[model samples]
Target: MIKFFRKIRQKLLSENKFSKYLIYAIGEIILVMIGILLALQVNNWNEYRKQGQKEIVNLKAIKNDLQHDLNTEFIPGISYYSKKNKDLSRLRDFYLNKEIIPRDSLLKYFRNNWGEWHIILNKGAFENLKSTGIDIISNDSLRTKISSLYSNGYPEIENRVNIVKQFYDNEFGPILYDNIILYDSTHSHDDFDDLKNRKQIGNRIIQHYYLRTWLFERSELVKSKVELLIGDIDKEIERLDK
Candidate 1:
């Protein structure tokens, strides 16, 4: 193509067709400019198409991750309820009925560990979303559903956390430590209820037992919220498929 253009220029100059040559040169320049512009436009279109595909894949992965977390962590996490109930039953049998102190410790490690772990799915997932900025151009329905899911779900989770926090601060913390102390000390199964009736022991037991009950209920509430979030993701995935 360059050779062709050069030959044309040489002929034009040799023939001394100055005005005609100027018009031809201008036309060639315009054609070249248009071709370059078209190539650039196609390149941009290809890049955008690739980005769109990536966004869809990322969204699907995020949806799956949320679903797995709901099933694995949220529900089983609340299984502490059944565990705690069993412990309580054993305690009742030993102290109230058998009048024998069991040697094993009876505490739900789940609720205790729950207070230690800081869980906010939004943090990591939202970071991924923000990094991609794909949600900016997502389908309107998908965007709306995502927004509603986070909004509706996060607040409930936060409320549950707050309730649990209050339980921990007012009831669980001191009582658990006191219970540990009693466990280590000379207190026996015979002193179970009466120990609570004592000025020092009674206050701690009342708080501990009350918080234990509340902890189980709060676990259920969190589980419900997580289930809702899973449903929200399912709806969004349906939208994506469409």
Candidate 2:
């Protein structure tokens, strides 16, 4: 094609058709420019397609992470914290009313009441997205939501959990260790009866109640955020599928 165009230009120049040659030269330049533009457009289209596929994969990964969290962390966490909160509330009521519960009951309530929340979010895809470029997500709203969930929502939940855990460890743990036979798994009725008579036990029960209440509230908040994130992920996934 280049040779053919070159021969035509040479003939035009030799025939002294300078005006025609100029026009032909200009046309050739326009064609070359059009070709370059088309090539660039095709390259851009290919890159867009690749990014779209990558976005789908990332969205799916995020969805899976959220699903895993809902099943393993959020749902179970909500149930566990809810039940524990109720138990602690009942125990607090007993302490306030000066009512004596069975030793096994008290032991049961205290044993499973406290738990550490260590939420492990699957942030690999998110991190990659952030590092590579947020534009890869395509959808502005979805990208914003993803960013908010990872940056603000997750960190808030983590901070809340850490605060509660620190309070338990630093403030409440030592009191139980010092005053109660915490290590005695096989606690007798006498041990519980003795704990009831201790004046400081009421304060400890109150502290436990407060902690459990905080935990329950935090668990609910985390669950809500997780649900919202899941919804956004589903929407993004659907969009990507199209």
Candidate 3:
């Protein structure tokens, strides 16, 4: 093509056709400009596609991280077992010694304490997501759903925590502390025998308690949310793969 254009120009120059050569030269300049513009457009398109694909990769990573967090932090099945173990040990000591519920207020105090602990753990997980910029992206539906879940869900948790805290402040701490001090100083009567007698009842009550049930339910809820997040990530990955 270069040789073909050069031959035409050489022929025009040999003939001394200055007007025709000047016209051809102007046309050639316009063609070169058009070719350059086309090349630039192609490059810009490629860059845009690359950036879009990179965004998808980052989104997938964030989704996977969210799923792992949900599984590790929110799933309370393992934690439930651990708490039960410690509670069982504490109950055993109380019962084996026939130690009466040193003060009627101890169980009440524990009930509130357990509730607050669950709320605090849940709140921490929710806040972690919020601490990142997970909520600000305008177009991702799944991300928005997860963000809304944390935002809306958190107020309920906060309210529950407040109730638990109020109960602890008003009722449990003073009563339990006073009795714990007296019992420690006095070497109180053997209460384990009494505890053993009521072991079955205590176990049943623990299972039915609101704190345990609430934690278990919310744990499952978060697990489901995490699974949905994973599913969304899978879709995005497949899209990018294509």
Candidate 4:
């Protein structure tokens, strides 16, 4: 092609037709520019396609993390706390009414009532997205929601769980350890509720119960948000597939 264009240029110049040669030279320049533009366009298209595939992979990774969380952490944790909260409520009510229940029942509640709420979120995919660039997600609304869930939602729930755990460990745990005569989960221990700080213990149990209740609700909230995000990611992946 280069040789062909050079031959044409030489012929045009040899013919002494300066005007025609000028026109030919201009046309050749235009052709070269067009070829450069087309090559650039193709390169850009390939890059775009590569980024699109990467986005889909990231989305799938995030979805997997969310699913694993629901299966292993969120669902089980929520159920555990839910049931534990109920037990705490009953124990609280029993304490309040000063009703003397069975020794085993009282000992059991005293032994296991102080529950801890802890949350650990899977942030691998999210961190990868952040390193690349959040805008890589493509969908404006989906990107925003993803960012909110990772940056704000997960952290907020984690912080709340920590606070609840701290309340249990620092306040309720000490009281039970000091006052309860013999508290054991597996072994049968002598149960006598004749503790010196009965009133203080009851109040602490009540306070811890409320905090655990709130923690349960917070865990449920985060789980629901994660479910919705998983659904959104599925929809986005479907759209991308086409």
By TM-score, who's the top model here? 4
All candidates in order of TM-score, best leading: 4, 2, 1, 3
- Residues 181-214 of candidate 4 have per-residue lDDT tens digits of 5535432332344541378888888898888777
Task: Compose the digit string of candidate 2's lDDT tens values, residues 134-212.
Answer: 7878888778888888888777766766766786677666666676654566567677667677767677668767866
**Residue 89: error of model 3 in Å?**
19
lDDT score, candidate 2: 0.75
Over 4 Å off, model 3:
1-7, 13-34, 77-140, 154-219
Alpha carbon lDDT of each predicted model: 0.58, 0.75, 0.55, 0.82
1-242 per-residue lDDT for model 1 (tens digits): 99998999999999999998999999999999999999999999898777666766766666676676566655655565456545544444443444444333433331232232223444456457767774643667666655555566555555655665676566656655655443243445654445434454334334444455555575576556556655665665565456
Error of 4 at 65 (Å): 2.5
Q: Which regions of candidate 1 deviate over 4 angstroms?
A: 1-48, 85-122, 179-190, 196-242
Q: What is the TM-score of each candidate against the true structure?
A: 0.51, 0.79, 0.51, 0.84
Q: RMSD for each model, in Å, please? A: 7.3, 3.3, 8.3, 3.3
Q: Model 2 off-target regions past 4 Å?
A: 98-104, 114-117, 170-193
Q: For residues 1-242, write the lDDT of model 3, one tens digit per residue.
A: 99999999999999999999999999999999999999999999898677656556556556656665565555554365346435544544454554345544345324433423433333354345456455433347866765665666545544554654564455544544443333332322444234335555444334334444454455566557666766876776676657
Inter-residue clash pairs, candidate 1: 196-202
